[model samples]
Target: MTVTDGVQRVLAELQRFGIDRQDVIVSTNVRTRLDGLPRSGEREPADSGAAVYWQERTGARRVIAIDHYIKVADNLAAIAATLDAMRSIERHGGARILERAFTGFTALPGATAPSWRDVFGVPPDCHDMAVVRAAYRRRASSAHPDKGGSNDEMATLNAALRDASTELGKPIGGEGS
Candidate 1:
């Protein structure tokens, strides 16, 4: 399919997730420096392609830039993969998913760090070590690697536990104690 066709497909997929076409911007004219450095005016044309930018209603924006000089098929494939991921996030997490998907960081919006309180399902002011340990144990039981869970999940749990311990001033697993 043509680049325009690919763009239309992406836009249509985003629209299905309640994103408006007007909130999407497609640009085919982009220039870059040849020396791989940022330059001011009149840089060389990189490729014959387009960049698709979508801004969600909640102010999260993502840009997908494709360079068609390599292969149009590859570009189209990338677009398809991105659309599939976006659809999955929207289906599972709704519009709030856009913030995490576009930001490259899993922290909540306007927050510099991911909250251990949120991960452990505790109140922000909760400082009791017993409460933190109880929450950690419950989460660890379900997220343990041997219980059909992933190593990544276990690692995340460990990190959250450490953070929660530190936040509560009760060091566990030999961290900050």
Candidate 2:
């Protein structure tokens, strides 16, 4: 599908959810010449993703975005695929998808920090700060430099503890055993 056609499909899907065209924003990196032609001998950038954002009727802002297109090289084609995914999401009740798109985990390019659960060796849904603290102390005992652990291990443990503390809305500082 052409980029324009993909954009139109996304807008129509948004409209089905009571989102007005004016209230929705569509974004992509594809740019066309004023005469609607690609420049001669010039290749477009390799960015092939798009994002759609709108404010829900409940005053909550939501977004559906895709920045990765596996095995897709052409920008327009990638954008078209991403838009198709967006429409499919909305058609199949996209509340969870929309929420996750807006507030999902983000990592720096080429560098991913370990998740709090992995660092603490806890279950994914472990949210109790007490459990977190206990895990931290237990890990710290083995990770501390004085206990045959390296500075890097201790640092990783401390960083994980701080992340969990903040996520659980607890105070930053805590005694580790």
lDDT of each: 0.66, 0.67
TM-score of each: 0.39, 0.37
In terms of TM-score, the best-performing candidate is 1
Query: Which whole-number lDDT from 0 to 100 does residue 37 have in model 2?
Result: 28
lDDT of 2 by residue, 130-161 (tens): 89888889988988999989898987888788
lDDT of 2 at 69: 61
- lDDT of each residue in 132-170, candidate 1, tens digit only: 778878988988888877887787778788887776677
Prediction-by-prediction clash tally: 0, 0
Runs of candidate 2 exceeding 4 Å displacement: 32-44, 70-177
Model 1, which residues run further than 4 Å from truth? 30-49, 72-77, 89-177
